[model samples]
Target: MRVLIIGAGGFVGRHLLPNLRDEGMEIIPTGRSPDRLRRLFPGCPVQQCDLSRDRAADWLPRLAGIDAVINLAGLIRDGAGGFDDVHEQGAKALFDACLAAGVRRVIQVSALGADEMGTSAYHRSKKAADDHLASLDPEGGRMDWAVLRPSLVIGRGGASTEMLAALAAAPLPLRLGPGDWRVQPLHVDDLVVIIIRLLHRREPFAGRLDLVGPEPMTTDTLTLTLRRWLGLPPARFLPLPRPLLALGAALGDRFGFGPASRDSLAMLAAGNVGDDSAVRAFLGRPARPLAQALARHPAMAADRWRARLLPLATPIRLLLAAIWIWTGIVSLGLYPVEGSYALLAPLGLTGLSATLALYGGALLDLGLGLALLLRWRPVAIGAAQLALMAVYTALISLYLPDLWLHPFGAISKNLAVAGATLAMMAMEAEHG
Candidate 1:
């Protein structure tokens, strides 16, 4: 059987492609970016289709001879415009095209808590699409549609899972209000098996089904489970008022950095859970427990270290930037010129030359710090800091060798700072 997989460049598609290949099914991956799709699914045919813009006529030609269409295309975090365009309008356009092309089967991977009266725009948009697909002509029609609304899909490679892991590995507990809301996280591997089974089922399946795990867990318990898996010590949490958090989320939304948002917080407050009967019936066994699923894939020392450092990345970067800016300020005018000249004189700098060197180095430091703060080319920033530190150490050793032996150990501290900077770079390269 040939399957047309939309959003094949996503987390689910990355796993689903290999599963389909193992089952000896021909795969056609489609996404907005042809280059990315090709990179994700090499040696496979890829088609470019933007759900936000394309219409039924645009997709009709691509559905030629396609046995089934798996529309796994949707957004979890986006602006309202993006949510409406991609989820609601996109689903209608694609489903209509599928009907027109006489595609026999279609499966939609939706979130578990999707509803018409969803607290978040994400849920509302997803529900709109799910409703549209279900309302399609079922009687005397060629389409056989089923929507799989799985709870939190936990996998090693998914972005959400990574975020959760990072949060769990944090030095301090991140308390989103009380962290009392519960969720049933389904293992992605298990979810994929169910999808493959549905594809090969003798009788076509229809309607929406919740694919959740065996047990429900509070958000606090979820974090603790991941923390335990990563061998982290128990951490304390400081719960702030919900209104304060909402304000912070609003600010974060405006600045594009904070994790919490109004809708996201509301969604979290509401909770995400569903019955696991359908999942158990389909798998012929209980769904994998959250801890078991996590322990199945052991995390390396580097992975653990990476997780521990992920939370510190932003703060460290800002600290380094502040150091540079402060140094620049002191060098510019705050520090006595006589002392600054005394330090520069040994290196054969004096008068205008000394002034230029002092101010110029200060400006360079300020600029580097600003670049680091802005998160512009993190790897390059780390490398530059190391190079600058090395140069300063060498110059100090040659010109004022006694400073190295001083009690303060000012020059010596750069070694640890450089190491920290390297760690930051590593985290950025991996997750940035």
Candidate 2:
């Protein structure tokens, strides 16, 4: 059947579009950006449409002859679009157009709390749209209408998931309220199956349903899941009162960073877990556990495994660099330190310039340490570290008269740092 998918450019679009393909639905998708739509459904018919400004009613005629309409089109645009424009105005635009086009079925992708009157403007608007979509005419029957309200969808490759990954690995950690707040996170794939099921459900289930996972997880347990999935070190949380949380939201408004909105914080506090029976009943297969989902979702878990080792590698590099540089520094007539004979002599660059050699060694060691720990530039710092060490080893053997004593020791230390630097660079190359 010919199906039109709106907001098919978003995170939801990525999975939903592909699943629709599996269902053999002839897809016509629209998004705010054509480029994103192209990436979302390459080679499929994708057109640019914006509910924010463009007359969606105008596109109604364009979508003529479509059998079903999937309205995933909504706004989270910094509270600017508000529920008024998107949910109310946008819904009417699509509804009028769909009615004119004789589209029999429409499935709305809305959030869990859309029905609540006092919810954030965005949610209030979504609920209004849900109410409106439910009110559509029944043509031959109640225009096969189903609404899916999924809780936080956990998946790899989405913006929220990426941000979650960053939050998981951050040294400063996140400032969450009491860790008691709970949410049921649905894996995108599992949620996709439900959405796909709604497209052509023979069982005849309708109306608003909360699509959520099997278990409820607190913010603390969520963080712990992130730690395991992301493989980051321990978190450092700084507490802030509810008033300050509002202040943080205001600052985010000023700074354009879009941290947790007041509504989002309220969501965290309220512990939203959508109803599960319909989804559980429909899938027949139980929802995957959060941990298994964490392991399975590659976007969050693939590079995730590397973040765990970053902290350990950082300190080890720092210590090794220190020892390498320290050996060079203490060798300059300050003490009768004898380790690794002269590395440079034939070029006639030694004596106090030999002191410059120690300075060079210090720079390389410190630079490499920072690079590995992500405190410094990877390419420049690694190069500096390797270059300086190579020079120092060669100069030491060449200049010191005790060159034959332990020549290999001088080369070995420089070689060690160079090897480590190269290894790090190689892994980055491979991953990139």
The lDDT of model 2 is: 0.66
lDDT per residue (tens digit) for residues 182-213 in model 1 = 88899888988988988888775678888999
Residues 257-292 of candidate 2 have per-residue lDDT tens digits of 433466666766777686688678769966787789
Give the RMSD in angstroms, all C-alphas superposed, for model 2: 9.6
CA RMSD (A), model 1:
3.6
Task: Determine which window of 10 residues in candidate 1 has minimal summed lDDT.
Answer: 251-260
> Which residue pairs collide in model 1, if any?
none
What are the per-model C-alpha RMSD values against the true structure? 3.6, 9.6
What is the lDDT of every predicted structure here? 0.83, 0.66
Tell me the lDDT of model 1 at 316. 81
Query: lDDT of model 1 at residue 377?
Result: 84
Provide backbone clash counts, one per model: 0, 14
